[model samples]
Target chain A: AQRVTQPEKLLSVFKGAPVELKCNYSYSGSPELFWYVQYSRQRLQLLLRHISRESIKGFTADLNKGETSFHLKKPFAQEEDSAMYYCALDIQGAQKLVFGQGTRLTINP
Target chain B: EAGVTQSPTHLIKTRGQQATLRCSPISGHTSVYWYQQALGLGLQFLLWYDEGEERNRGNFPPRFSGRQFPNYSSELNVNALELEDSALYLCASSLAKRVRGQPQHFGDGTRLSIL
Candidate 1:
């Protein structure tokens, strides 16, 4: 079975502090990972994908095959960064996406 | 270009009734997907339609069925609605069949409530 897991249900950090939202997956084959964010009163949207290796809104996630993890990280947390983040996995040949329970990040000023 | 669009931002239905949800893929998109986001549970894939064919489906029961139109628009019908069926139904679109790294554009979603 393929599964995505975000260990932290809620992560709180003070403004300017570093933030990390851990994500892990279980798959037999190579996995494509993605980070999606949903802000208050807004639609859920893609934040970044591991293949792109691009940072969006000061956030970056590295896919570590050895650890089976793709944790999202930011050097300095901002108030606007607070949102519900979900980690997803797309296996080869499957058009469907498997998503994690999601983690809510709160940046307190 | 317009993003994926879904109808009836919110819906209310009685238990044992049936409910239908609609979605229109973005211009030129050939694939449409449906997902359910319950209160506690995470987003779960419901169905996938491409080129007017059902490519794949989640673990949901046959009561949850849908079809795609020639225009690339789609409709999801849930039979025998139960209270547990209340959720946010999200629709997404992709240019082609989902490859390894293709990102899906999403709609705001329809909030369905079962009484």
Candidate 2:
């Protein structure tokens, strides 16, 4: 079974502090990884994908095949950065995404 | 360019009633996807439609069905709606050829309330 696991449901970080959201996946073959974000009253939007290997809005994630992890990180958290983040995996031939439960990031003002 | 659009921002239906949600993909996108997000729950894939055909579906039951039109628009019909069906139904669209790698653009979603 292809599954995505997000260890934390909610993460609170002080403004200017570094933040990290953990995600782990289980898949037999090579998988495609993506991070999606949803802000308050905003629609869900793509943040970044492993294939692109780029950062978005100061946040970045590295796909670690050995550890089977794709953790999202930011050097400094900001109040506007608070949102719900989801880790998704595209399994081979599935043609659909398997999303993690999501982590609600809270940046303290 | 305009993004995906979903009709009826909110709908309320009682048990055993039916609910229908509509979606219009982006201008050049031919793949539409449906997902359900219950309160305090994550998104669950519902169905996928591409090129006016049913491409794949999640673990949902037959009661939850949908179809894609020739124009690439889609509709989801929930029959015998249950209380658990109360959730936000989200619609996403992507390019048909590079679907897996293409980021899906989303609509604000239709909020369904089953009472």
Candidate 3:
């Protein structure tokens, strides 16, 4: 079975500090990874996908097949970036996605 | 273009009762997906419908069922609801089956409370 693991339940960082939300997956085939974010009082929205290879809002994630990890990172965290981040993995042959427990990131002023 | 829309922002029901949640995908979108976000379970896939057909379903029991209409709107019906069934049900939509890289746009979700 395909599974996604997000080790951190909450991460707090000061503004301008670097942020990294860990994510790991267990799948046999080529996996499609995505990072979704939900801000306060807002609906969940897609932040970026591994397939795109383009950064969105200063966030970027690289697919590491060897380590089975797709960690989301940003060089400088902003107060507005505080939100809940979810890592998802789309397994082979399954059109649906398996999501991690999500990490609530709080950027302190 | 408008994003995905779901009906009844909040729903309250008692045990053994039935709860029906509705979702209308964005204009021209043919795929709709249902997910349950419980307190601790995160988001779990419940159902997927496209072109008025049930394409996939999660590990949820048969009590959790849904259907898509000709206009690409969908409804999720939960039978014999239990207290554990209380959660935020989210609805998302995409272009179609062939749009591999398209992200799923989501709605504000319906917060269901089972008494």
Candidate 4:
């Protein structure tokens, strides 16, 4: 069975602190991972994908096949960065997304 | 261009009743997907439709079914709704060109509350 896991349900950090939102997955085939963010009163939107390897909003996630992880990280946390973040896995050729439970990050000023 | 759209921003129904949710894909997009976002459960894939065909479905019961029209718009019908069936149903669309890792555009979603 394919599954995505975000171990932290809630994470808090002071402004300017480093932030890391962990995500792990279980799949038998090569995986395509993505990070999605949903801010208050806003629709869910794509944050970044591992394949793109580009940073979005100063956040970067590296897909580590050996560890089965794609943890999202940022050098400095900002108040605006607070939101519900979900880690998703795209089943190749299936056009489906398996999502994790999501982690709500709170940046306290 | 307009993005994907979903109807009836909110819907309310009682147990054992049926609920119908609608979605319209972005122009030129032939693939439509449905997902359920329940509290604490996160998002779960429900169904996928492309070009008037049911491409694939997630691990859900037959009571949770849907279809795509020739216009690429779709409707999801939930029969015998239960209390646990309450959720925010989301619709997404993408080009059906078999492109590897194509990103999907999402709608605001319909919040269905089962009474």
Candidate 5:
């Protein structure tokens, strides 16, 4: 069974500080990883995908097959970056997502 | 292009009652997905429909069922709702083609509260 785990239930950081949201997965097959964020009063939206290898909104996540991790990272966190971050794993070709418990990110001014 | 839309922003029902949630995909999207975001449970895949067929479903019970219409809209019906069933039901849409991974666009979600 494919499973995603986001270790932190909540993470707080001051503005301009670096942010890293940890994510780990347990899947036998090669997995597709993604980061989704939901801002206050906003719907959940895609943050970044490992396959794309492109950064979005200053965030990037690299899929580490060896370690079975895909941690989302940002060099400089902004106040607006406060949101709930979810790490998801796509179940092979089925494209069904298995999401983590989610990490609530709060950036203090 | 309009994003995915879900009906009844909030729904309240008592135990043993039935709850029906609706979702309308993007204008040209042919795939619709349902996910349940319960407190601490995160987002659990519920159902996936494409081309009016049920493609995939999570480990939910038989009481949780849904169908996609020919026009690509879908409805999720929860039979005999229980208090534990209370959660935010989210609807998302993406292109059916698998060649390139199209990110699933999610809606605001329906807040289903079972009393």
Candidate 6:
């Protein structure tokens, strides 16, 4: 069974501070990871994917197969970065996503 | 292009009743996926349809079923709904081709309340 776990249910940080949303997964096979974010009134959108290895919106996540973790990180947080962040794992080639409990990120002004 | 769209932004039903949620994928997309966003469960994949066929489904009961139309739109039918069934249902779409690893685009979701 593939599982995604986001340890923090809520994370708060001041603007310009570094942000790291922790994510851990339990999967026996090779994994594909993705970070999805949902703003106040916006739909859930893709933030970044490990397969692409490209950063989006100043956020990046590296797949650590040894540790089974794919933590989303940003050098400096912004007020507009406040949103609900979800870490998802793709189940092999099935295109199914197993999501974490999600971390609500709040950047204070 | 328009993003994935879900109909009936909000739905209210009583226990034992049935709830049907609709999803229209983005244009040119051939795959549609359904997910349930309960209070604490986060997002659980419910169903996946491609090319008018049910490709995959989550651990949900048989009461949770859905189908994709020829046009690539989809409908999720929940039978004999229970209070625990109340949650926000989200729809997403992506290209069926697996080579590209296309990201799934999501909709605003429909809030279903079971009384």
lDDT of 6 by residue, B11-83 (tens): 9999999999999999999999999999867899999899999998988999999899999999999999999
Note the residue pairs that clash in candidate 2.
none
Structure candidate 5, residue pairs in collision: none
Q: Pick the winner on TM-score between candidates 2 and 5.
A: 2
lDDT of 6 at B17: 98
lDDT on C-alpha atoms for all candidate structures: 0.94, 0.92, 0.92, 0.94, 0.91, 0.93
Query: In candidate 6, residue A19 scores what lDDT?
Result: 100
Residue A59 error, candidate 1, Å? 0.8
True contacts kept of each: 0.88, 0.68, 0.61, 0.61, 0.66, 0.66
Give per-residue CA lDDT, model 1, range A1-109, as digits (tens): 8999999999999999999999999999988999999999988899999999999999999999999999999999999999999999986877888999999999999
What are the RMSD figures for all models against the true structure? 0.8, 1.0, 0.9, 1.1, 1.1, 1.1
User: Is candidate 3 or 4 superior in TM-score?
Assistant: 3
Please, what are the lDDT tens digits per residue for candidate 4 over residues B9-113? 999999999999999999999999999999978899999999899999998899999999999999999999999999999999989954655677789999999
lDDT string for model 2 (B44-95, tens) is 9899899988888998999999999999999999999999999999999988
Q: Clashing pairs in model 1? A: none
Candidate 4 residue spans exceeding 4 A from truth? none
Comparing 1 with 4 on DockQ, the higher-scoring candidate is 1
Cα error of candidate 3 at position B104, Å: 1.2
Candidate DockQ values, in order, are 0.87, 0.73, 0.70, 0.70, 0.70, 0.70
Chain A, candidate 4, TM-score of: 0.99
Best by lDDT: 1
TM-score of each: 0.98, 0.97, 0.98, 0.97, 0.97, 0.97
- For model 5, the DockQ equals 0.70
| Isolated chain A TM-score, each model | 0.98, 0.98, 0.97, 0.99, 0.97, 0.97
Candidate 5 docking: what grade?
A: medium
- Model 3: CA > 4 A from native: none
